[model samples]
Target: MRESLRLLRDELSRINSPDELSSWKERFEELLREAVEKKLGVKCRSPVYLFKTLYHAGFINREELDALLQFDELNDPSFFERLLERLETRL
Candidate 1:
């Protein structure tokens, strides 16, 4: 997970336009889902933290964030709510 995030960060640094950033949104979402699934058993906070980091870094905008949150695989409304609350505070 840390390695994936590192790769994402490195890729983000190379983004030269809005198009490039837009292209990465799905990759970020995939990473979030994978991280969440891998850590689901342990109740790890990595997924939320990764979202926050991507958001703060401008790798994703509000719309993308919402889209990512809409993932049904999470199957946890409270977790989504908590992440939404965290995002609101950051905004």
Candidate 2:
């Protein structure tokens, strides 16, 4: 998971156009969905860890990180919905 997130961060850092950014956002949302589904037990921490890592690494700004972290306080069932909503707004 850490490796995956790192790779994503690397790709995110290389993005130079809006199309690339949009693609990245789609991939990110997919990753979040997968984590929520397959890593049910780690859902709470995994996404937060990845997002925080990205923020600290300068891949994402403070505002984006804060919005993503908002899911931390949400119930498990609402995680995907909230994340999708945030991502849509970002796009």
Per-model TM-score on C-alpha atoms: 0.46, 0.46
Please write out the lDDT profile of model 1 over residues 1-91, one tens digit for every residue: 6666656666666777656665665575566656554654323355566555555556457765665555434433334345434433432
lDDT by residue (1-91, candidate 2, tens digit) is 5455556666766777767766776576567555444544333346677677656545457866777776434223233334444443332
* CA lDDT of each prediction against the hidden true structure: 0.54, 0.55
- Which residue ranges in model 2 land beyond 4 Å of their true spot? 41-91
Candidate 1 structure lDDT: 0.54
The runs of at least 3 residues in candidate 1 whose Cα sits more than 4 Å from the true structure, single-residue gaps closed, are 41-91
Quote the lDDT for 53 in model 2: 60
